[model samples]
Target: MSTPRHTLAQLCAAVTAAPVLLVAPAAVAAPQAPPPSTVIGGERLGLPGVQVDPLAGAPALPTDLTGESWIVSDATSGDVLASYNPHARLPPASTLKILFADTVLPKFDRNAVHRVADEEIQNIGAGSSLVGIKENLDYRVEDLWRGVFLSSGNDAVHVLSHMNGGIQPTVDEMQSKADALQARDTTVVSPDGYDRDGQLSSAYDLSLFARSGLRNADFRMYCATREAMFPGAVDKNTGQRSSFGIANTDRLLGKYPGLIGVKNGTTTNAGSTFVGAAERDGRTLLVTVMHPASYQRVYDETAELLDWGFASAGKVRPVGRLVEEKQAGGEQPSGQAGGTAGAPPPHPAGAPAGPVAGSAGDDGLGPVGWSAVLVGALVGAGAVVVLRRRTANRAGRLWK
Candidate 1:
């Protein structure tokens, strides 16, 4: 697709119109109620269009940033470093998988095994990315997660959704989980994030999803895994299952300094979307870039924002903060990530020891040769509560 003729001019106009602020950033909250609507964090954040609060000595913010929307924030402090149309709703592509992972990762012990069935894989959307999942194959819970994190496989996502129940159930749960996180800009019409009429998410909401998902250790490990050996079909002659390698789709996983795991997505409808995390000197930053005009620029713009965020760290005041999980419009942990009291242990008997080597096939950038491949969330008492109870009841049958 050709670049839009007026994108640069519009962006420059947005920057020139933004205000310059020098006030110290502060944390604000009203635990007794849902998030305030004025500005979401402060008045500075509410202004229409792109909002960039400049620091006196800090070098200019990236001039070449391109995307429909984007955000950079400090994971620990929740300070929104910078944004442009952060709340604009757009197709999330596979980046929405972060929320899917956050909602489902804590429910099952990684060792739990499930055999894929025909119905489970029957309904995946066409032309979507896939990790080669086939019917009647038995896979550990951890294996399915790797397909998701690495290959961005819709097939793997459908299998996992069936394990949780079914597609509509998982979609409902995802929507409720998004609501609980105050990510109101999202609509969960499809669990695998394949484009649908009503499905959408904003850069702000996607960041919240990534921040929450990163709190879980399993979620963290899977996203950071650059490569892994995925189970292959059983040899009919010997009845022994073989394995093939898969690599994480996230481009920055190894090339970028301090870059941690996250996710990325691309589709004709959504363009390109990505949410990435990195740790530098004990400080972690989260960046989300959605619908960049080109596949490569999505990554380039993200890296640029991250660079600006790190360099401008102490110099700029935060425009907003990522809201905490809430209940009845108040602070609570019932559905919190990595903290659900009744959730299964992070690791059980069959947990993965470590990731494997990179492969020649799909790495989320482009496909190479070779075969092999394949492809969550909650509701009620917040989604986690319902999942916790269900997981407890289903534990006995999990590995059968």
Candidate 2:
């Protein structure tokens, strides 16, 4: 006998009368599979069902980017405006130092001094960049950060990492921090971001790190500094203290109008990677370009992306969400009403529970999903009927 066809009203009534399953919402809302275009190495780079659409009314998205992966996002709202292969994992080079700084920069007092050990300097890879640090020199935390930011100094990263505890512990902590930030594409084997086996990060994750790091005033200052004198050791032969001026490696800082401090990185394997930020007309945009064919291409592409982001901020729709930072214990903030476990706690009375920054789409729903529970419920009954029919049709075909 053919299965009885249920009308939409009947399906709604059936769904309403059915015993409700009391499973946690998270169990029901399993992460959706990302689109095929956003996948790399079988891993989805973006949230499932999220589409990377261009700005609705802005100029066409830049087509000349030579990087393997790139992203442009609103720093204030955390919305990704445009991206290409954002999750493609590649060598991070010095760009990984941003994560290292984010992890350890807050742990020590910038005014405090630490003596550099020979082992710290010795561990840097050959031909790697250095801030000209020397053993037995006591350098202030502030000076070390300058070296790391201005000169892309591997030596400075090691000294700071050593101060945090040890190189290995620092690396471990950085990995932990990346996890907390939901930067799932990052893996840190070296504190200084030198080429190491399995040391990789995606453009999306790198932008996330840069965004988080920028929240710190010191981090912002370090990356924006055009030129600063770095402390150096007193020559034993001459018994005279010397200091060297380090210029910011990020070419976009002073050269690009409205550009601010961030970072840049390059290596034979990594090619060129850059995370940049700019503000125009009170709106700030962040861009990340990874593994461009040439060092200059990173900046050119970044500028193009930033310009697009600034122009499209209010006009363009978001394609994907930058996942929120996870609180300790592996629970994500609940999206349900009444704020269940993992939900953001209620704000004080009269205070605004402002629109959440960094959500996937403009309404927090892409073309594939609903933005709010009320909206979803309005069509829930119809959805149930369609879903049931599809399931039944498949079952009948199997039987035939």
Q: What would the TM-scores of all predictions be?
A: 0.73, 0.72
Write candidate 1's Cα lDDT for 100-200 as tens digits. 89777888889999989898888778898888988988999999999999999999888888888888898999988987887767899988889999899
* TM-score of candidate 2 relative to the true fold: 0.72
The regions of model 1 sitting more than 4 angstroms off are 1-39, 328-400
Number of colliding residue pairs in each model:
10, 5
Models, CA RMSD each: 26.1, 11.9
lDDT of 2 by residue, 344-394 (tens): 222333332332233221222222332232232234644433443443343
Evaluated at residue 168, the lDDT of candidate 2 is 93
TM-score of 1: 0.73
lDDT of 2 at 17: 65
> Which consecutive 10 residues in model 2 have the weakest lDDT in total?
336-345
